[model samples]
Structure formats: C-alpha cells, structure tokens
Target: MPLEIAIAGGGVGGMAAAIALQNQGHNVTIFEQARAFGRIGADVNLTPNAVHALDGLGIGDRLRATAARPEFRISRTWDSGEETSRLPMSAAAEVKYGAPQLTIHRADLLAALESALLPDTLHFGARVAGVSQTEDGVTLTFADGSTGDYDLVIGADGIHSAIRHALYGADDPQFTGLVSYRGVFVRGEAPDLPNLDSFTKWWGPTSDLQIVTFPLNRGEEVFVFATTGQKDWTEEGWTLSGDIDELRDIYKDFHPEARALLDACTEVTRSALHVRAPMPRWSEGRVVLLGDAAHPMVPFMAQGACMASEDAVVLGCALEGVEAEGLPAALERFAESRIPRTTRVQEGSLANDWLKKGGNADWVYGYDAWGALKYEVV
Candidate 1:
C-alpha cells in the first residue's frame, strides 16, 4: 500500500527522503519555509558514501557535471606550508569506494535534489508551525493556520527543528566555543594558490585554528573556510556578514598562499558552531526526525549532509510497501539502525580531528547505505 507522507523542511535530507519514498511508490510532499531557492554560496563535500546514496537516487550524472573532483586531500602547516599528509581522492576514491568524491556548491547540490522531485510535490512558503499525531494519521499545521493530514511526517527541518522540539521537548543547543568564516569566489580571483587541484587544509600551530580551501563547480570556483576558537559569539545564522579585514588579520601569519586566498575573498559569512547530544530515539508515532534534526554535529568530518542523505536512504528502505499500522514499528527500526552510526559520527565531529594526519578513511567513506539496509528489512 502506498502511503501519503508529509515532510517538513525541503533541504537536502528532506528532498532525498522524498525521492527515496517516491521510488517505493509513496506520495510525498515537502513543506519548506523559504519562498524559493537562493544561490547561497558555500561548497559541500560529497564523499563516496554520500555519492553512492545520491547515485542510487538517480542524480549522479547531474552532480558529476556540476561538481569538482579533486585529485587529493592535502594537509599543510599554517605558517610554513609544509605538507603533512595527502590522501588520494579523484580516481582513487572511485577505485577504493566505488564512487568519486565531489565538492559542489550548496545551491547546485540542492538544485539536483529538487530536480528529481515530481511537480506539485513541493510547497514553498508553507512554514511548519506545529505537528500533532492522532491514532489514525499525522496532522501538520502551517504558520498560516492551514492544516494537512498524512500517513506519516518527517522532520528534516535542520538543527532548530520544530518537530524535534514537539516530540522531545525544549532542549537547547550548546555552543562549542568555535566559529567559522566562509567565503566562495571564482577561481580566477585566486589563480596563484598552490595545489589548486587539491582540497587542502592548513592547520594552525595547534588545533585551535585552521583554514581549508577547495575547488567547486568543476574547478571554476573556489571555496574557503576558516575556523578558530572564539568565546563570545551570540548571533546565530549562516548568513551573518563577516568582517573581511578581521578574517585576514586573524590569518595574517599563515602561509602566503593562504593569505592570498583570504585577500581575494570579497565577501564572507561567519557562524558559531553548536551541537546537541544525540538522542536515544528519533521517531515518535507517525512523526519522525531526520538529518540535522535527529543528530546535528559540527562540520569537521564534512559528513553532515552525507549522514542526512544516508538516513533518508535507510528510512526509505524501512518503510517501503508497509501497511499503515506497521508505520510506527518500521520507523522505530529505522531509528534503531541509524542511531549507532550517527552517534559515532556526532562524537567524532565534536573532536574535530578527522584526517588531520591521514589515516584509514574506509570506515567513513566506504559505507554503502543500500547495502546496509538490504536484508535488514522485509
């Protein structure tokens, strides 16, 4: 029996879930608060794990055409520019993990996911005000007081998820005493950067500060992200304008190549990092949480989006062809299977020590969501 499903928050995770469920012959609608998509300029890494899942969702070709496949993942000293470690990525990733690693603009990735959806499936400007579940179905209330009923609801609404709050109660996110400044610009602006063909990170004398740079849009643009320990950052949002001068001054002692990249950046945004401890459960009745809503972590591992996509794939497998009465049990199974992996990732990201010295990455990059879910359900 095909189920009628409603998903709150039309982000990467939500749209991926819709595609997976729709493939299983379910009717899925996504309610997003934003009026329309914006070309928000930040790059996201699509490791082999994420690539394999999206490839199964049928958007692999679109991603390859628009994203850059760096030849290496490099780590260097902040001031001296001494190479500490290098990991093969481009062809090596495909050979080792069965999918290529890609770095793409956030907008481009979202567009690919959005293009895979059916028409009239997305309801923009329909902010989710509240959600409640009855014995028979789930009711989703929009900010304008309109209501819709569905067989199940997915809360992929991000870190500050209303559905999560409704199900688990009011729990606040704790600041991690770290902040990041990020900017993206055309590659030509920073043409002289060394190792332009690789994704490189310059580690500070200690672990307290770092700057990362990589190519995106098939090497036509560059994305730079710098993180440092900060004590008093209160404003919260991904779009808060950052001081370009302050950014340069903070890294003035870095390698000349890194300094040049910062000098070329015309615009930047800063956001304080925050995390919520992983919840023991992710589903309640017909309403469940996915992605950042279920487990929000720092961006150290570059797996935040990847984990969300993985969750969507696993959840879709768990619910395929199930009767309405079995929905709760299926959702519980989905949460049970996903919590262990996501919790490990959440804790690892908080430590922020992924690949700094280069170690075996197979555990993180070689995961296959489709394979994991096979035989676990049905």
Candidate 2:
C-alpha cells in the first residue's frame, strides 16, 4: 500500500530519500526551509559504495557523465611531497566494487536529483518549527502556524535538524577545533598540476594541516580543500569568506602540487568543523532520523553524504512492503541495522582520516550497498 511520506530538509540526503521512497510508489514530499533548491558545499565524492546506491536511483549514468572518475588515489607529505600511499581507482575500483569512484560539484549532483523527482515534489520555504506525534501518524508545525500530517516523517534536515530537537531536545554539536579552506577552480585556470585525473591528498606531519585535491566536471575544474588549526570558531554554518593570501601562505612551503591547486582558487570558502554525538535512538514512533541528523560523522572518511545515501536506500528497503501494519517494526529494524553500521563509520571517521593507515580501505570502499539493502526482515 502506498503511503504519504514527508521529509524535512531538501539536502542531498533528503533528496536521496525522496528518490528512493518515490521509486516505491509512495507519495513523497520534501519540505525545505529555503525558498529555492541549492547545494552548499565544496564538492562531493561517491566512492563505489555510494555509486551503487546512485545506480539504484537510476541516475548513475547521468552522474557519471558530469563527474570526474579519478584514475588513482594518491597521498603525499605536506611539505616534502614524499609519496606516502597509493591505490588504483578507475579500473581497479570497478573490478573490486563494481562501480567507479566519482567526484562532482555538489550543485551538479543536486540538479540531477532535482530533475529525477516528479513535478512539485519539493515545497521550498516550508520552515518546520516543531513536530507532534499522534497515534496514527506525525504532524509537522511550520513556522507560519500551519500544520501537515503524514503517515511517516523523515528527518533528513541535517545535523542541526529541528525535527531531531523536537524529538530528543537540545543536542548541541561540538566543534572539532579545525578550520578548512575550500574552493573550485576551472581546469584552464589551474597551474597544470599533476594528478589532475586523480584523487590526491597531502598531510601535515602531525595532522595539523591537510589538503585534498581532485578533478570535477569531467576535468573541467579542480576541487581544493585545505585544513588547518583555528582555535576560535565563533561562526555558525558551513561557509565563510576565506582569505586567499592567508590560506596560500599557510601551505607556501608545501609541495608545488598542493600550492598549484591552492593558487588556482579564485573564490575560497571555509567552515569550522563540528560533529554531533551519536543518538542512541534514531527513531521515535512514526518519526525517524536519517543522514546527518542521526549520525553526523567527521569528514575523515568522506562518508558523511555517502552514509546518508546508504541510509535512504536501507530505509526504503526496510519499508519495502506490509504498509501501516508493519511500518513501526520495519522502521525499528532499519534503525537497528544502521546504528552499528553507521556508528562504526562515525567512530572511525572521528578517530582519524580514512587514509591514516596508508589508504588500505577495502572494507570502506569495497562494501556493496545494493546487496545490503536486499536484506530480508528477520
């Protein structure tokens, strides 16, 4: 039986959930606080684990067409430029995981997801102030004193989710005491740096300064991310005006490869790192948390979005059938499975960067999301 499903937040995770549920013939709607659909981030990577989930949404080919597939994964020292770790990316990724790792602008991925949904599936400027749960379903109270009810509500509203606060109350996120500069530059404008067709990262001796570079838009542009220590992060949100001079000076003594990538960035942005404590309960009655709202991981694994994408796929699979009679149990099972799966990711991401042990990530990159979602309810 088809059900009325409501999702709070229209981010990548929310959109992914929308696509997954909509494919199930459910009436899926997204309530976004913003007036329009836009993605705010540097760029995103879809390791093979996430690529499989994208294929399930039927946008695999479209994403591939617009994204860059790094032929290899390379890591180097921050200053000396000594090659520290390497992994095969293109052919080897496909052979081992059945999907190619992809990197693309956040906007491009959002646009593709926007096109996949049905007409008017998204309701922008719908600010949800609070939620109320009844015996049958969930009711959302908007900031405008309006309310809407649905058979189920998904809190894809991201880390600062109001829905989560309404359920559990006052879960403040702690800053990780790191500030990073990020940007995207046209390939033509770059210094013709090496690893243009690869995912290359540079690390400081003590994990104090780090830089990650990769191509996007089929090598038409390069994505640059540089992390350094900053004690005071009095700002809120993911984007702040970045000082190019200050950023460039920080990595001045570093290898030319990293310097070249940083110099090409015309518009630099920075964000203070913050993360939330894992929730012991991901669901309450008809309301459930997904993505960052549930387990906002550090970017070490670059699985923040990837885990959310996996959550949607798994949630959809768990709620595959049986309708209202089975909804509660199915949701519990979904949360149960994800708590451990995503907790490991959350903890590991917090412990160190995924490449900390010289990039031996078979367990992280080689996992199959498509097969995991096919699990039968016990």
Candidate 3:
C-alpha cells in the first residue's frame, strides 16, 4: 500500500513537501489554517541552495523566468553613504556553487507550486489543532473539530506549529529583537536610480536596513523589502500591517539612492522576526517535523524556505522503505541527517543577521549552498 501522509501547513514548505512526496508516488494531503496561501513580501532572494532545491522539484526555470538575477550584492554604510563591499553575484556564485542565486515575488513562486498540486489534495481553512501518534499510525484533530488518520504525519506548518506543540509542548518563539517593514515599488516611479540589478543593504549600529529589488512579471513590476530592528516591536505574525511613516523615519539617514527607494514605498507590511532555539529532537515515533516547524530561523540568511525544501526531500528519501517494517527508524534517520545541518544554518543565520546589523559583509554573500551540500553531506 502507498504511504498515506497528512501534511500540516500549506505555506511554501508544506506545498514543496507535497510535491516531493507526490512525485515519489505517495499520497499526500496538506492542511492549511489560512483561508488562502500566498506570500506577502515584495521579493525574496533564493540563494544557490534554494535554487538547487527548487531544481530538484523541476521548477527552477519557471522561477528564474519570473526572477531578477542580481549582478552583485551591494552594501553601504548607513551614516557615511559609502560602499562597503560589492560582491559579484553571477561569476562568483556560479563558479563557486554551481547555481546562481535568484530573486522573485513570493506570490509567483507560490502560484507555481500550487499549480502542480493534484485537485482536492490541499484542504484550506483546516487548521490542525493537535496530532497524536500510536504504534500503527498518526491521528490529526483540526480546529474545525474534524479528525483524520494517516500512516505518516508531517508538521510543515511553520514556526508556531500546533502539531509541534502536540508532539512536544507549547512554548514561546524566541524574539529576535527586530522588526521588519516591507513594501514594493515601481521602477518607473523612482527615477535616476542606478537600476544596478543587485540587492542593497544599509548597515547601522544595533540596527540594519536591507532592500531586495527585483523585476517581476516580465520586468513589469519591481518588488522591494525594507527591514529594521525595533527594540520595542514584538509581534510574531509575519503578515501584520506596518506603518509607513515609521519606516521612513527609520531609514532617514540612508544615502540618497537608498532614501529615494524608501520614499517610494507606501503601505508597507510589518512583523516582528522570531527565532527558535534548537530542539533536541525533531521526531517522535511515526510523526516527524519539516521546514519552519522543525527549525525556524531569522530571515537574515534567507534559508528558511530552502531548508524546508531540503527537509521534505530528505525525509521522503529516508522513509522510502518504512511500509515493510515501521517508521521509527526512518524518522530517527531523518532527524539525524537534518538536525546537525539545520542547527548549523540556524546559528549561521542568527550570526549573519547580527553582522549585517553591524555592517559586516565580508562573509555574508560568500556562501555556496550547493558546495556545502556536496562537501558537508556524504
């Protein structure tokens, strides 16, 4: 019999897991709490690692078509308006990692993933409130008071995963002590800007601002993201509406180019970034966790979705032969293979975040996710 899998969460991670599992000829169902699922941010950078993961899913070209390949990564000093470092993206990234980093609208990526799902497989508005696993199978109880059973259960529901709470316990997500404000702008609206085809980040002491500018919809729309550390802001929800004036005041000291970009941003979204401390274990019995549910990190590294995609593939591969015996050992193997790497990434993202805030760019853009996968993993 094919493995019957119930996936909790319909975000990027969940959808990616579903695609991977379905490709392997298994039955997968995704339970999402939200009425709909799509990304709100203007644009997000998919490092080489994420591109590789997306390639594994056969969607890399589609993603690339809608993305802007930044020529380099540009960093500037917030107070002095001086270029700190300009790292080449195309040559260095391809020669070093075997893949090029990309930037695209979150919605475009989600739509691409969603278009691949089988009809009626994704159940929206079905929030999983609890999950219980026994020796034979796992049972899921949703917020709507419905119940379902599956041979395997995956908690890809994200940082505040309710399935994780059932497996472990309720705990607060660690506050990263930063707040982010994001919005998109039109290229035609902003004039005389360099149009550098590069990601720009401004650094300051105890706070930092970063912006992602990429062309979307065949160069028709420009997407942007601006984030700052707010000592007083505390909200974990990523989609919470943010104030534009606050963002304007926050970036008041940036260079004219950066300031013009910020000035063009209107109706920005805000959210408090949260970090999760590593858990000693990510699986218990037949139930296991994937993506942000297993390891949620600060967006500093932008590996959150990439790591989740990795988990889905690894978990499905590790559990390839469980039907003949059971899933305990497979689940254990998944944790062992994933935990160390993800933990390192978690710490690395946090460290990079701190460095970006302090204007340290020497090591940030030099990562090779494909090489890391080749050398680090056997």
Instruction: Encode model 2's per-residue lDDT on 137-236: one tens digit a residue.
Output: 8899999999998999999998889999999999899888888788988888864577888998887766768888888999888888888888887987
**What local lDDT score does residue 169 receive in model 3, on the 0 to 100 scale?**
94
After superposing all C-alphas onto the true structure, candidate 2 shows an RMSD in angstroms of 1.6
List lDDT for all candidates, in order: 0.90, 0.84, 0.73
Candidate with the larger TM-score of 2 and 3: 2
Task: Give the C-alpha miss distance for residue 262 in model 2, angstroms.
Answer: 1.4
Task: Put down candidate 3 lDDT per residue, 296-353, tens digits, no spaces.
Answer: 9987666787787677667766665558246877788778877887898899888764
Error of 3 at 352 (Å): 3.3
State every prediction's TM-score relative to the real structure: 0.97, 0.96, 0.88
Q: Give residue 262's error in model 3 in angstroms.
A: 0.3
Q: Which ten residues in a row have the lowest lDDT in candidate 1?
A: 369-378
What C-alpha RMSD separates each model from the true structure?
1.4, 1.6, 3.3
Question: Which of candidates 1 and 2 reaches a greater lDDT?
Answer: 1
User: In TM-score terms, which candidate is top?
Assistant: 1
